[model samples]
Target: MKETAEAYLGRPVSKAVITVPAYFNDAQRQATKDAGRIAGLDVLRIINEPTAASLSYGMDRKEGLVAVFDLGGGTFDISILEISGGVFEVKATNGDTFLGGEDFDNALLQHLVDEFRKEQGIDLTKDRLALQRLREAAEKAKCELSSTSQTDINIPFITADATGAKHLSFTLTRSKFETLVNPLVERTRQPCKDCLRDAGISAKDITEVILVGGMSRMPKVQEVVQEIFGRQPSKNVNPDECVAMGAAIQGGVLRGDVKDILLLDVTPLSLGIETLGGVFTRLINRNTTIPTKKSQVFSTAADGQTQVGIKVLQGEREMAADNKLLGQFDLVGIPPAPRGMPQIEVTFDIDANGIVHVGAKDKATNKEQAITIQSSGGLSDSDIDRMVREAEQYAGKDKERKALIEARNDADTTMYSVERSLNEHKEKLPSDVVEAVQAAIADLKGSLEKDNLEEIREKISAASRHHSRLARPCLGKRAAAARLLLGGRPEEPRKRSMRRRSRGTYAESNSQVVVRVRCIKLFGPWEGQDHEIGVRHSCCLIAVTGIQSCTAVSIWAGVLH
Candidate 1:
């Protein structure tokens, strides 16, 4: 995708702001960053998808509380944000990573399968190909029913039984389709409610609601969003492209193309350390704006302890064992003291990219230990470095392989075009010419089987040469017809014009005189054909004669033809 973008823009793309679901965990976000690094991109920011969509809708410039409801193909997310003075701050975000349009499609697909089974007495779901067709038809009908009252799904010869082939046909109405997928649509409501509750606001506080993603285009989904938010979903932006537009807008800001717009995202989950007695301690709560830090002082669990283990964890669970353990480290070198006497200050810091850093400092001795939590789901630094090295090692071979594939594609295309032309104009050419063109086509086809790029290109050129020969006769006929259309006489050729200017100097002396000559010559059309033209030649010469010797020099000469 990076290469494709570069090809389209005719330049290298190095920096990008990627978007992920707001509910993506630390591991998931880190994995996304790792993917960008592997693709040779400097990932500027990993913004949430809903936030990006809000930006695309120009919510950054508006002053209000807005809800961005995003239901894409495979995931759903609800984000509540407050926009003021060009600063868009996310108040809260909630989502179901598994519920989305795919679920709706599957629900409709199951309905069709059940109906087919009841009528034909054969389970179409048992056949892979039939199931695939049903899935396609189900998705099409779902999209159609969004705009129309009803749609017909007909798959001829969907499957064959021992008796004979069977056809599947069904008409699904919008009401019935809604009935089948209403449960899936309702799953999105609780997330919105949770997001609103986390944001400390009710439905009335939201000034506007923005719908995003392909599934959000459904009328039923829109109705549900309106029912949940007490306002119709905003249609100010395209649901499918708003996320991408928001990303592009953010990229522009990073590139200094935009100004005065601030984007503040919240951490999806809480971050804290384990306290004494296996209890979870919250330093930074979930939905808190990031690039933030909090510190709390605790003491050693045992008497006269010199070291304290800082077990960092994330999640909303009250027990340390229930939450995810991010990383752990020990702050040592503390002066021995009784329990609850030594001051061990534990600080949790979350950066703008949602990466966590945990540190513990012994206030008594000024000793500190900190760890940057690495994502367990992503590659390590050494692994990324090794992969980058391997990519550089094989870069030339990859280019060569791509060139070979392109050469083969070009050869195949030329062969197809030439074969088509030969069949169309076979009567216009002599038998020998036709045969020669066919033989060239055969040679090109045979070269396609070999791995030699130069050989395939040579065959392609040869085939084009033969086809050009065969086309000459047809070209003459077209020319004659054009002449006949122009009152039985060929059209007058366009005139050619040339202009020239020159300047030089001659020196005179008692013993010697020198002359410098610079000439530029331009030629006109060749062989009385206006399209076949010649080129220009320029040369400079110097001649000198003295009392005792004579010298001549040719300084420069160039010819273009």
Candidate 2:
């Protein structure tokens, strides 16, 4: 739900109240904010999982303790809160990091597999695809059980033979299905208690209990909620649409479409870095509404060291290693200082999108670096720009010319090797292989010595790309096999040679050493008009005497070895 909302920002949809899982930590919440910023948006406010449900319920007149139990595909968040004068302040929220409707679906699928295995005596768990189809069916059944009380799910024709033959089937009921997933559903109590305590409320204070995620629609789920809250929960809001609707409403808030509506939110978890005592020095704590900034310093750990490595971490852990490695950097070439003497002021700021922007500077030198954090496998703006520049530079090169040089080199090497291989392995290879390789080499040679550079480029590129295919029966595994066998693979020959063509390499891998001689060569000072040509990249060791007196002048064009 939050992923889609993040996308809606800065596009056709102008605002939104993104609902985060009640258990989302400050870092995760901040990361979501970062995602929003990247989309060029202002996250009006982050709505907690349960509060979003209350807002969408349209319970303006009713007043009672409410338990908003939301179970998602991969997370469970339950919050108990009150509604007074449209103020749906949450009293508390709790959840599991990895428990929800998805778990129940998986469990039910497992149960089906077990039942089938015991009856038919066939263990089908090894079939991934069959398992996936079963999982999907199980989920569908779970959803059906939510409102209808019972539904029969078809688990037909799963296994298949190479000839496309299918082999099996079954069905499941609500009570049996609930029994399979009941343990997972019951795991939400701890967080529920924690959330209520966090909000300074209890089951008695929650004026009206509400249900949120699609999983909440389950009769078994509702029974549990009612038992805990001591009242029946509101089932009015669509389990799937409430969070989205709340987000859209918040979007309306950001656009000023809804006036006099202010949403003040809090940080979700503690944020800080490891300190000397291995303690988390909390820069920001749970429930602190954001678009915030905080700064710190970097200093040398040893005397005279010129660089200090800086690693910015997230999470509420005293040890740096215990936290997430959001990013890494170094303050380079610092003035030499005594151990722990250099000061580098660093700041880690979290914007509304929850993205961290870190900056650092040497207090004495004021040398600095700044960058935004992106999760692994994704590049930051700087890296993206660098990639763009690299691509442009590569595109600027004459690919045609480059391709020609590579192709010609291929032909040259292959011709030399194939000729030698045919002589050495002639006995083992078939006559056709030898003859074909010889013919291909002849054509490549002609192409290389061709007059037109254009034709040469085209043919060379074509030949190099296709060489492996053409040079078959080159059992010797030759790089120059392109010039060896006729354009195809063949069995191993008696022997084959792979000799590199050498007069000069096709590339200038190493630069030639040269001297830069700056000179203003006086051409015709005596020819009525004095003229000088500025020459650079010249040899200076040679001394030259003038032998010029007119229209044409020549200085010693010394050739250096």
1-561, model 1: which lDDT tens digit per residue? Answer: 789889999999998899999888776788888888888888899899999988877644777998999999999999999888888899999999899899999999999999988998888777765687789889899889989999887665466555544667787899999999999999999999989999999999999898889999999999999999988889988999999999998998888998888899999888888888899999999999988999999888888888878888989999999998887888878888888899888888888778787888888788899887877744887888787778779999988899899999878767765765576667778888899999999999999888998998899889877755654555444543333443344443312222331333435433222333333322221111112112111111111111111111111111111
TM-score of every prediction relative to native:
0.68, 0.57
Can you write out model 2's per-residue Cα lDDT over 66-141, one digit (the tens) per residue?
A: 6778888788887665655655555555677699777888798788888767866666788655676677778887
Off by over 4 Å in 1: 304-307, 330-336, 392-561
Off by over 4 Å in 2: 1-51, 58-67, 79-94, 127-129, 148-151, 160-173, 277-279, 295-307, 332-346, 361-368, 382-561
Clashes of 1: 0
- lDDT of each candidate versus the true structure: 0.77, 0.59
Cα lDDT for residue 340, model 1?
87
Number of the top candidate by TM-score?
1
Best by lDDT: 1
